[model samples]
Target: MAKKSKQYEYDLSEVKRLIGETDKNYREIAAETGCPYASVVYHGRKIRGRVNRMRQEELNIEEQQPVLSITEETTETPKMLSGGTALSISRSDVHIHDAEQEAAKMIKAARALGLNKVNITIDR
Candidate 1:
């Protein structure tokens, strides 16, 4: 004949409730609640650690998102300046000296054609 092993019955809800109600260690919780010491230690630590990790992840996601503010002035399109023209070029596509050379050529041509008040804008 084979010998049968006996199982001890425990309530997980009661264990969790006790763990939440006190700052005591697993051993203290087990003694107070009449639950197994190992069960209290494992489940309590695991649940608490998981909650903490999830909170940290949420905080990280919040930090990564940019905060935007709404103001009345920013809703309207800006009006262009009168008699102003823009010459825009990318810095990576052309060097500053090369841009200066091109601007000089344009200016020389404009002056030869009797044109004045030319506006040139170079930005990175």
Candidate 2:
């Protein structure tokens, strides 16, 4: 008589939820779930396929409805700034002292705008 491998009982819904919520790779999910990486990939793919089919059905229902038109008129006058206004300082015009001041100003501005990283590229 052949013996069956011990199966770990877990909520399939929870497994699917974790996999969808995180960007973790299959191996990471397998480690966390105590399942084989292959199984994780297989089950995850199955769950995602099912969800996609359900979404397609919902979209088909929505497509049967008539589309509504939306229009809005602007009331406020548009204001435009001319050249050499607010932070229009050119890189060529930047001296060592000016660069330091500009760097400080940029740091403050970036923090205010909640920027995580900034990339600057110079072209000749």
For model 1, name the residue pairs that clash.
Answer: none
Best by TM-score: 1
Model 2: ten consecutive residues of lowest lDDT: 70-79
Model 1 lDDT at residue 116: 54
Assess the local accuracy of residue 97 in candidate 1 as a C-alpha lDDT between 0 and 100. 30
lDDT by residue (1-124, candidate 1, tens digit) is 9999656577888889877776676777788777888788788876665444456578677656653321112123333344564332222334333556666776776566555545554443
Candidate 2 — which residues are off by over 4 angstroms? 47-124
Residue 113, model 1, lDDT: 51
Considering every candidate listed, which one attains the maximal lDDT?
Answer: 1
Query: Candidate 2 local accuracy as lDDT?
Result: 0.55
Tens digit of per-residue lDDT, candidate 2, span 11-120 = 66766776788766667778777776677778777755544445757767865664332222223332223442322222443433345566566557655655444433
